[model samples]
Target chain A: MAEYEQHDHDHIEHDHMTIPKYIGIFLVLVVGTILTYFAATVDLDFIFPGANTLVALLIAFTKMTCVMLFFMHVYWSPRMIWLSAVASFFWLAIMFSYTMQDYLTRDPGVFSP
Target chain B: MSSHSETGKFHYHEPGLQHQFEDMGQQEESVSIGMWMFLVQEIMFFGGLFTAYLVFRSKYPMAFAAGSNHLDAFWGGLNTLVLIVSSLTMALTVYYAQKSNRNMQVIMILLTMAFGATFLGVKTIEYRDKFNHGLVPVQGWNKRIKAETNAEHETKPCWEVDHNAPAIEHPNPRGEFQWTDCSLVKKAQDEGYLTNAEKIGYFSNGEIDANKFRDKVRIFYYLYFVMTGLHALHMIVGLALMTWLLIVAWRGSFSEDYYMPVEMSGLYWHFVDIVWIFLFPLLYLLGRHFMHGG
Candidate 1:
């Protein structure tokens, strides 16, 4: 058992993420949460119908970046993993934008006939 | 270490590579690719709901605004904070697991579970409050304004000359009126539409309104329940995964080399947390403009 453990230990690096990095990520998320709440309380309707949504999405995107880069270890991962992650988001955008274009631009009056 | 050397230019795969993989690097790449593919499908799942929200909000902008105002921001904000904190703990757990610190991994996993439970508990309180007030979207429970008046007559023996005296006209008998029992059945009852005792029983028994509310709120609560409830369910799953990981961590299953499971699970948990971050604002904060009458 000990020999197997030693053999396993030799291949893996023991030190990458440290306590400071963890604390830093935690602080960033905390700031994002606070900002989201603050933005929600403000009246941004004059800007657009979905201004709050945009703000919220921006914060969410920031939070996701933190998670993907830090928690998922994509920063240290090979290029292929990073590319796959980016590709997933690209496909998601295509799916969302295309479907929403059809729904948002349709005239309700067209169905009356 | 010299086994490869003694084999004389052997091109063996890395030990971590599964039997079917061409090499260790290929195996890692495949696993990462598979996870990304799964995440893409998750995006599509959430995308369908987002599209629905867009269509509905555009159709009934005012109604959607009115509906969004009903959600309490404090609870929503608190839940957001809780999930963010939990994500931090999950990341830390993976970090410790990678370091071969079994004790730290267990501690962080337990902390993450505690945060997850806190979020669900707060959500339960919010749901109960919505049900108590007739904010739950149901046929009769949607919105009902009831005007109740009570007259209390006290007769003193010396002050009353005639026992059969005409009842004094209390023009506006102001009694303690509350929004008590303002549900679908009570709304239907006040409307005087259904007189059948059986029908009244059906409505008044709380079953009909509850069902109506379920159906009506089904759209809102469907999204609400489906999204928040699904997020809560994910939290539960994360807790279970953490427990299993914790047990293994306790047994020293993860080391510097073998902590991929812990790392991958943490990534998933963090993604779930990020979903809630978006959900909080979309569901709870988008319509604050209508709160003060738009």
Candidate 2:
């Protein structure tokens, strides 16, 4: 099994991405960006207040996923690599969640200076 | 190293593996894991700034909205597109590196650098516009602002203040224009906009006296400078890394087996692009009900 895995790993041709797939991902990314710009341009506050920011963030998240999955090869990478990549974001979430606990409740007057 | 390659027991030879590693696969895996670890630290670093920005923006929503309106979205959008294109080129550079296509790899890297430079150029133009409007934060700058604001009381736009025009000094413009909560009291009151006791310049003695309000909006500029300034610094570092990559790549140093440099730098570039992805929307899209004003 170790020998078989080495044979697969040492060959670059076995799992490399083709040019067309990369080009397709690029085009999709461009469209996602344009869609995000349009979403920001139109006010959606009447549907629900803060909907505009909501829309912008959702579209940005979509675009980021595209970059991560295809451009960064997270989709095709092994489980170990995927875990490493996901761990970074998980740690980032922890940092944000804990910091915001203190930040969101702080009195406005605390920043008067 | 030569003996290990001849024995064929090591799939990846000793030259690719440092003495401490069992083999090249282990060495490469650790390197990959290490890069991700570094990127995690980077995310946390930027997370602190974003958190601070969020807290201030929540506390001062209207001020933030007004600040957001002042930024031009078209240029910000253009930068977003440019950065996305740069990421595409960068990813392609990595692809070509893995294929051992030296010329295409070099070309893609140069194209990425060009887009990065273009992003910086657009940013410089935006910064220059802000300076011309006297929006930069400098100590004692509000003194000039007071004279300029008072001079503009005669239908002159504060942004259009002439250096040659005679200066009229207003007593305590900082205190006069800025109060505890009132953003534009004298101007808003004159414009017949009803205000609560906050906009009114009242001291503890019940007498109307300027205490401090003119510089509250400057906080927005302070945040803007810190965020975009750090971003520009990152672009500078990315450019320097690209220059080194260019030299080594031109020397035919990268190939299918040795493409770690290209892959690592591509990760860094995409990370920067992702940062801009968040920034463009938050800063440029926030209170632009429509600058077209149609």
Task: Give all TM-scores, in the order shown.
Answer: 0.72, 0.78
Off by over 4 Å in 1: A1-15, A110-113, B1-27, B136-218
What TM-score would you give candidate 1 relative to the actual structure? 0.72
Flag clash pairs in model 1: B138-B213, B140-B184, B141-B184
- Please compute and give the TM-score of the first chain of candidate 2 against the native first chain: 0.77
Candidate 2: which stretches are off by over 4 Å?
A1-14, A106-113, B1-19, B140-216, B290-294
Winner by lDDT: 2
Candidate 1 per-residue lDDT over residues B1-294, each given as its tens digit:
012322323444343445565444455556666776676677667767777776555443433444566678899999888988888888888888767788988899889889988998998898776655554544353324343355454343211223245533322222211121113333333544433322422333544433322232346555665677777887888888888887888887776545767777877787788788778878887767545342
Error of 2 at A28 (Å): 2.1
- Report iRMS (Å) of candidate 2: 4.5
Candidate 1 docks at the CAPRI level of acceptable
How would you encode candidate 2's per-residue C-alpha lDDT over B1-294 as one tens digit per residue?
112334445344534445566555565667667777777778777877887777666545445554666678889999999999999999999999888899999999999999999999999999876654555666534333334533434343232334355643444433322212232333333454322322332223533233322253556667788888888899999999999999999988887767777888988898888888888888888766533221
Instruction: Encode model 2's per-residue lDDT on A1-113: one tens digit a residue.
Output: 24534533543231456788888878887887788778877868679766888888888888888888878776766577788778877877777778768766555454431
- Which numbered prediction scores highest in DockQ against the true structure? 2
CA error at residue B128 for candidate 1, angstroms:
1.8
The DockQ of each candidate is: 0.28, 0.39
